[model samples]
Target: MNMLKYPTLLTALCVSTMLLAQKAKPVKQGNKSHTDVATVEYLPEFTREVPAESGSVFKIKNKRYNLEIRLWDQKKVRIVSTVPMGSDTDTLTNDELYKMSGVTLSAFGKRIDLASDEYPENRVAEVTNIQVQGLPAQPAKNRQDANGAEEIVVEGYKTTTKKQQANVGEVTVVGYKKGGTDSSGKTPSAFPNRPVKDEPASIYGTQNPQVADVVVTGYKSTWTRTSSTRRNMVVYIPRDCKLVVDNRYTDIVVNEDLDKAEFTLYRSNLGLRNVNELRVDASFYTMYAGNLGYADLKLASGSLTAGTIDNAQIESTGSEVEYEGGNTLFLKSKADRINVENVGSVGGYKEFGELRIGKLSQDLTLEGKSTHVKIRQITSEVTAIRISTQFADLRLPLKQLTGYDIDFKGDNSTVYSSFEKKEMNANAGIANSESLVAAGVTFGNKAPAAFHVKSDESAGKKTSFNITCNNCTVDFK
Candidate 1:
């Protein structure tokens, strides 16, 4: 966040709304080209300084800079680079820099404010005078100009302006909001080399914007690509610093135990030995770790492998996971495939996924729909079992369930066990949709599908089941 200081006219835009407008003399906004104003120049050699406190945060923002972070005894971060770029400046325009960036405006009157991708979101001399100055002529589609906004489509740009009256309450803005995050944590430039003009619609009059005045500043910047390819960085960071990273597709490795690591990743991969705690919000992420004291993860379309986590809370979609074991596990998943070799206790809900557990020692409580659950062993440490699922499959070994008093209930699901299962309800009417199944399975419109089971022994630990099914054929072995 250490950017160069700018004059009051550059780098800030506010479009706050619902403010009461007032009657003020309208200073006609003048039309001016961005090229006539300030131009930002980037230095080739950049150094980021980290504070020597434990609360210091080191952020890796730009994707062009590839980095490897390692722990060191030094209190401050140190960067080692070979053949660093000379003091020359590389220039990039607002068009290339803010291409796919979202609109970042604050402070708006109760009127229309139109913005388009044709103009830079943070550039100088934009949104000037009548009809947005410096824009090339565009084709008029015979559309009526209403609400003080005139539709004008110029070459490679299309937008509207509404600054005609302070009472303007609505607007049409285009272009600057097309894409999501890129490699860098910043938004890509929304405009092109040829800039466009956006009209403020209305900023004065009885509009009661109520503020002294709405001041939107823009800066001038330039980007010139260099062929040096001198982006690889090796930095030694203090182990005590708390790191918050927004990472892209780079592979990051931390060789030692980290104090704490929290990050948001996109298509990135990471490897860590150990952490005090790790919190991640990611998509398309791949992580490999030795052990974590605690882990809270929300993921989509990726994979996670860890050795032992003391506590794990995860929510995933279409992801794969493999773990050795943990103290406790809580999961909510959809279309995920997970394998846990051993754990103290487990509780979760899933849909259309597969969960395989080698051993559950303490207790197990899970409920879901259309899911496949398999447990190799549920030891004597488990004193209670409460499982409820519909249209789901469950497979458990005979040893764990042998000494328990079980209560099972279902509508149309099948059950198999070592002892004789007392049927609580059988041959009950279910959904009429079962008529599409085998011909002789139903009595006219009613499908004979209800089922329930209870162990005859009343001695051992308690096991309970509650199920409601429609067209669900579950086989419990």
Candidate 2:
């Protein structure tokens, strides 16, 4: 025994002891800290992590519009709005916009002049490829003055107005909505204006009065950059028109001809609590639209399910996701290369890909050729791990693994090695790896209740140990 190396071992032991004492959860730089799942939003230029209750409704100028906002109760933000009203221009106070629940602005006549610092460029820009749906319905049939002909409701009128370099402006009838003010129904004359009701009508009439139609039309234009500095743009949506998210416009786009200054989309954070459906569609990358960092994912409490590749390729170079609470994590993509860490539990299908876990609660089944499957900790009473890789090599530093069942089935594909100090009471099967190392498995102190290791004489290589049990027998041909 060399006594000099004992001093070096003591020094290493001391350093490792301090490191283990200081061990903590890995923290990534620039990771959006989410307090709750519901208050997270992923927009082009806007990345905000707000509290759950910050999502509320308000009314502005008797018009109801949903003010989707990202609010951090602990911090402060600067909000600005420039709106085009009729032939005149108007500006709305942030406080006034916050008071609106669902505001309806006429689409037939309006141009929004907007600017904001909440954006990156310090300039408000127009959003093209504007798609709107579910607008207010058309008014009831009214007779025309000329020929007693019923007026027709235009599907969506489109007309060209002005054209400039790179910005060809046009107004198109977009969408419509229902509720706002009662311009449709006029006050009826009571017996030729004999006398108005002294008091209001019965109860139900107190509800919101219905308006005729709320049409949204505007010149969807694009702004070009003259300088190299990053441009920030704020898109102004009518208070009533809920911004719809599509895969085409869900990412940031940047190119030589047109560069993206900044992009963002926000919604009232109410669905965080009641939302049971979570869909992830990630397949595009542009200056205007691009892959949203994990910071861009919206959080909800419903049973979570993800589609095949939420985006085209989720590049997890220096990123990790921290989930608050979920029972299951389903990987539905084919031949997906998903990098996951720090999840509570997995209760779904994990047929392909490599899963590296800091902790696990259930069994992990790897049937296909998965090269780097690793498990660090088992926080359950019983942990079952099944690996069917072509070359199944188990390398884990688990502390309290009580039971295990391992079945290896591959030709010249499985490599068996163990560094466990204590023999685990496990049932294991090694087949067709075409290596003699499989016969050298030495059960430490405890052996599997039933063990089977079979290979033909031509396939048998060498054995370094024999069976020690009187009741248990080993047949080697």
Candidate 3:
């Protein structure tokens, strides 16, 4: 009996030791430090107080799955997942369900990466097309079925419709209440002749005025036309009011500071202008502004020319946009052309388009495929510039390069620059191309100014100008 007991005890001890070894083992990830998740512990919920930086990538993982979230330009977020078929498909645990909810995935400051140790694979998920959330809703697509019946298919799950109309001579003002009050606690009138007492109070009270008011001028007896036609007129708008303009066939012109007001516009053709924050969505129209404030402009096959903007977000399809001064600019376009003279901070995604920029005061970022870019100058205030492209050519003509750190990586491509050969640290034959090259240059004549350049290498907490191109040419002068 004693011998049997001793054998049983030894077997029990061996089994416990095996279990401990399995739990302690770590799984390796690609280039990253290994994490041990064999114990299967749940992580605390993540809180994203600030917006993630544009173009940053984040990851979320559970016991049996991994999900990647990429923040695209214009508040768009793309989510992709990796889980074997039929693996944890049903009966998901509480932690697994939360990981897939996307509630913790904030779309706007730095990258957030969270992982579980239970599942470890060195695989970088294959690039497959995925839909992104928060992009401008596309128009319904027309399709013909097998029975030859026409069908309209809308792509988005949510839709909103707003409509406003004004008679031939009367002016209409749609203004949000938040902008109606100044710092002095006064409710200003939206129009010149309209009195503050006559204007209706916002239905949405003072806390959060999501509701807007529509004030219309008295109808004129002389202007009694049924059909809408373009009329030349001048309009005044409130300094801090939000304005929304939607027109089909109107040519608009905005004048700069004709009056003592914040902005003034003299419209030779029928169009709406003025207000503090402006948003315009037009088709088949031409708009010109001398000096602009913050605006969100969307166009479909038209042109908009502006002189200056504090902050501007532009989205266009087959349109042309030209602006001179901008502090922060976000552009999203397809088959469109954008020309800007001076910008403080600019970043966006463009496809099959052309971008011509004169000078960058801060940083410029581009991420897209098959686009041509030309940048004239990089100012001393620039912190970092990053461009990732495929099948695109980039040209930069630098006025001076004393304060920049440059990195260029190309596959099946060439890098041509006028900088002295000694300034570059180049390596040939990188990943996929025999002619691939990685070049690094730190500008400055004296001791390099604590600046460093990296090519085909990671940039950690450093201000850099990083360019990655495939099947393209990068030229610097």
Report the number of the highest-TM-score candidate. Answer: 1
lDDT of 3 by residue, 1-477 (tens): 564669878888788999877644433322222221111222222222223343343333222221211212343332233222212235554445445433333332444333333212212111011122211223222111111111111111111112122211112121111223434554443332222222222322222211122222221111011112112222222222122222222233333332111111111122223334565665555666666677777777767777787798888888888888779989887888889998888889989788888988788898888888888887656778888887887886544444445666555665565443223333432333221133445433221211123323332233467787777766765
Count of residue pairs whose backbone atoms collide, per candidate: 32, 40, 6
Per-residue accuracy of model 2 over 353-388 as CA lDDT, tens digit each: 445655555545444443344656654443445444
Best by lDDT: 1
Candidate 1 displacement at residue 193 in angstroms: 14
Query: For residues 119-152, what per-residue lDDT tens digits would candidate 1 score against the true structure?
Result: 2333322222113333323322211222122222
Is 2 or 3 the stronger prediction by lDDT? 3
Q: Which candidate do you rate higher for TM-score, 1 or 2? A: 1
Off by over 4 Å in 1: 1-49, 81-230, 425-477
lDDT for 408 in candidate 3 is 60
- Candidate 2 global CA lDDT score: 0.28
Error of 3 at 283 (Å): 1.9
